[model samples]
Target: MRRMYFIFLMLCSGLALAQPRIQLSPPQAVVDSVFFTETTTVRLELDYPGVALRYTLDGSPVGSNSSVYKGPLALSQSATVSAKAFHPDFEDSPQVSIAVRSLKYNQPLSITNATPKPAPQYTGAGLSALTDRQKGALNFAATPKAWLGWETDTLRMQLNAPEAGKVNMLVFSLLDNAGAWIMPPAVVKVYDAGEQIGQFETARPEPGGPTQYHFLEVPLKPWSSDTLEVLVLARQLPDWHDGAGRPAWIFLDEILLTQKP
Candidate 1:
């Protein structure tokens, strides 16, 4: 009987050590918008009692020892807010992250004219759409849609800036939806006052990738000009695509001009 009691005690201890730790649910992130002009605030909430929320803004992994959540965070630049819940009774919860973009330095740009106008069905808000701050959703057909789609190989846009300022960067909000045969611009060339100043090209996208929006940032040699011209080139659909041999459609919603301080 003594030997049996010792054996029973050993089995109980083994089972206790083998038990798995429970994980709490991830915290919920509350924010008005993910894209902001100058600043925005993000708040985290978890209803479980005794549970603490921890977060990071620098894309670092959140752990039990991370900074504890005190209140909403005020952010001025682009960042990704990642948060997780922690509790002594349970393992750390899975991390949840939200990305926020800043278009704070968007200078006012006027579209004087455009060659090869967008399709009638997807004109968006017309020429003003290119400079408008509005963004397009994943669904191209969703209303009030903000996507200006072109089925041609190239698009030439005439732009005029009312204010004289030096610009260093241009951000183009483009859509890449393979299912709809819409591809991002393959190349973008910028001309300041009829002189070619900068040009950039993008690699062909992998086939069968999920539909998503992309923000392409092109850095240029800082230059100041009131009148400008932009050329966008479309990619030809690969043989693997359903619309093979044809020029893939290109969709653009907004262009943001950023000037160095």
Candidate 2:
């Protein structure tokens, strides 16, 4: 009986000496994704203290061999990012990876739209605005210089492609501040001259989300055209919503044209 009690005490002591499980925070969508038009700055966070986190951007194994995270990581192109948390006595946390992507369009763009509003000095943009590589944040006015406003319900634009190739994606980055009565469009259409190429639709936000930002991208028919025309029709607000009769505002920045030729 004495020997059995001694062995049980040893097991209990060993269990008590073992280190606790470490929990690391993963990148959340709104906070990390969709915040930029050209480049995205990602920061790492953890749920527990005293953990040393290491990360890699090149899809390599993450460990002490990887770069120790000291500050926010900036990514300009697509990468498979991996991270792991390390502690002295505890087993290393499982590797966490996320595929990060952004539009890499720096092509000079020529734009022609019907009845386009003059971009305001501080908060608006013109035809050349989309390719300017500027980005907006959570606030409707955070990156105002990058945004161009249109008052009409319908918008028509003709864009000249920089390279002749297949465009895989078209990113429509937009802002939603319903209280200010600025909302996303009901439907958007892309045309290569007269033929329809791609179409995108948006999901309405549950009421009471003020100043929300969303990236709405759609797959193209893998279009190959020198010039593309885009049409956007805003959703008509109901009587309960303010700014009726008044034209819905379409705030646009970086109409990202992602192509691989």
State each model's C-alpha RMSD to the native.
6.1, 9.2
Q: What is the lDDT of residue 222 in candidate 2?
A: 54
lDDT of predicted model 1:
0.81
Report lDDT (Cα) of residue 172, candidate 2: 73
**What does the lDDT read for residue 155 in candidate 1?**
92
Over 197-259, each residue of candidate 2 has an lDDT whose tens digit, in order, gives 889887654555546544567556755678888888887765566655555577777666675
Per-model TM values vs. the true structure:
0.68, 0.59
* Deviation of model 2 at 149, angstroms: 1.0
**lDDT of all the models against the reference?**
0.81, 0.67
Instruction: Report lDDT (Cα) of residue 30, candidate 2.
Output: 24
- Candidate 2's TM-score: 0.59
CA error at residue 5 for candidate 1, angstroms: 35
Best by lDDT: 1
